[model samples]
Target: MARHSFQSAMATQAGNGHVLGYTVWNHFFRPETDELHPMGITQLNRLVRRSWREPLQLYVETAHDLRFDPGAPADYAKDRDELDARRMQAISTYLSVVANRNDVNLFVHDPPRAGMSSDEAWRGDKDMVHGAPRGYLTAEAIAKGAISSEAPGGFPITLQPDLGGAGMAFPQPPNFGGDIPVGDFGGDFGGEFDVPPGF
Candidate 1:
């Protein structure tokens, strides 16, 4: 069924005590259109029929980037890896919380296995190589004082780059020509300094 209409029906059910609330799965997208329309009666009826047995549930898509581009930089690769790691950790933490509370059911499709094309990978055929949605859940936990650290499995968690100044640094490549004169490198790198013997 078209997602909007399904959502509307779910809302109606919630209002009438047919259900408490519903969860939405998959990416949210709206086609470019001036007016929104509801799903067909057949689809709505099918959904309502299933609602009798199906609990309110939502699906969380794997938040991983699957496409590979050969031209990406080394820095980008490193940053992407770090970001994915953090994301997965967050998801783990969130799952842990949900399990503890037993209040809501969260559904996630298994990621595809390794070595698959992006299109095939989207079918849950292979695991993701990058871009997992883990960190946000951990971040929310931390903000709510639910978790002391962002680490999953009870391991020590280091500061993530987004957390503050962690992993931040000024690029200081080796001065192959030796240190340039302070006058030559003015502004931020400027100031009075003793000249080297050679200079």
Candidate 2:
């Protein structure tokens, strides 16, 4: 079955003089088997409603490729650009809804550092497009003693532990070292380090 009625909706909206544009790059169309589930519109809605947080992580990790034909006319290129912008705006809106509902922070990934341009940074990793929330879902967080839901407010009411340290730390290097000795150190050089005498 088709994933979403996005194209038809876009057509109707455009007919009504809306600024929205339509294109296949939006990934809202139906997919064949072996394709990613929940194409575009459904994916956004599912991310908002998912009880598990890992799927959200996966969604951010998945790449969204936007390509254009090299020989397309200038007018077609302009339309495609506009459509792409609208699609991205829609995705951002969905993310905002999910973050607000869950009472979690949402932010764009950090800007590129030295030796990396902004475009390269974005294209390098799909996860780099958005920052992940620090803690798991409210229930998971509460069970882990990371937070409390009994505060005066709703859903994500209280913080039993600070959010800053909730996320997993980056991987550390394994502890290991070579036992080989260097020349002039402790062990003999096996006479392989013979050097000519200097005047």
Candidate 3:
């Protein structure tokens, strides 16, 4: 699924001639499901190397923690912490190889903390993982500015111009022609799962 999504984004970049960036969430790798354990990282490395060969910029947000609910079990929290550490380590290793720290830039979300209650965190009304919308907004804005060269203070930026492009162009995803299915909603939706305009 990650590969497909990454390829799709690359294809979109190809068509639009815009830069590509990604935010890799820490929880995306489920220890129970072994999501992106080693193989996924390998594939991602290949994709990054391929994309790095392009003249465009590539931004990546490394694994970041957003506190999880333990539901009163201390052991569960401990296990989750351990699993998160391993995933972070794997990503760190991958970045060491693929990330040049310049054109292939790297950034991270704010460190996880008890900034909100478990209930609030679960609701994610403010942000995706924590109820801190301000921080998310600030981070997003800074990243956008840095990518567009319209703002400064995106630290750790070191200029290197000698780097050149190489590697194969990423392939586009296979098209399965059809409108996406939007499950049943009580309200009147347009035909074939299409949302009504101004919805």
Best by lDDT: 3
When summed lDDT is taken over every stretch of 10 residues in candidate 2, the lowest stretch is: 167-176
> Which portions of model 3 show Cα errors greater than 4 Å?
1-21, 25-30, 33-35, 50-72, 97-199
Query: Per-residue lDDT of 37-130 in model 1, one digit per residue for the tens?
Result: 2332232234334554544243333334434457876655565455444443443344346433223344544333324678865856323321
Q: What would the TM-score be for candidate 1 when compared with the true structure?
A: 0.19
Candidate-wise lDDT, in order: 0.37, 0.37, 0.41
**lDDT of predicted model 3:** 0.41
What's the alpha carbon RMSD for model 2? 24.5
- State model 1's lDDT: 0.37
* Clash count, candidate 3: 0
1-199: candidate 2 lDDT, tens digit per residue: 2535887877776653311221122235222211323565565455456634542331121113434456875655566455444444445555557554433232222121225677777777634322222333454554677543322222122232334433221111111233443333443222121222220
**Residue by residue across 13-130, what tens digits does model 3's lDDT show?**
6754332224344444553432554555654565566676653233233333335555756765576556555554555565655664233443433333324788876677524322
Question: What's the TM for model 2?
Answer: 0.23
Rank the candidate models, highest TM-score first.
3, 2, 1
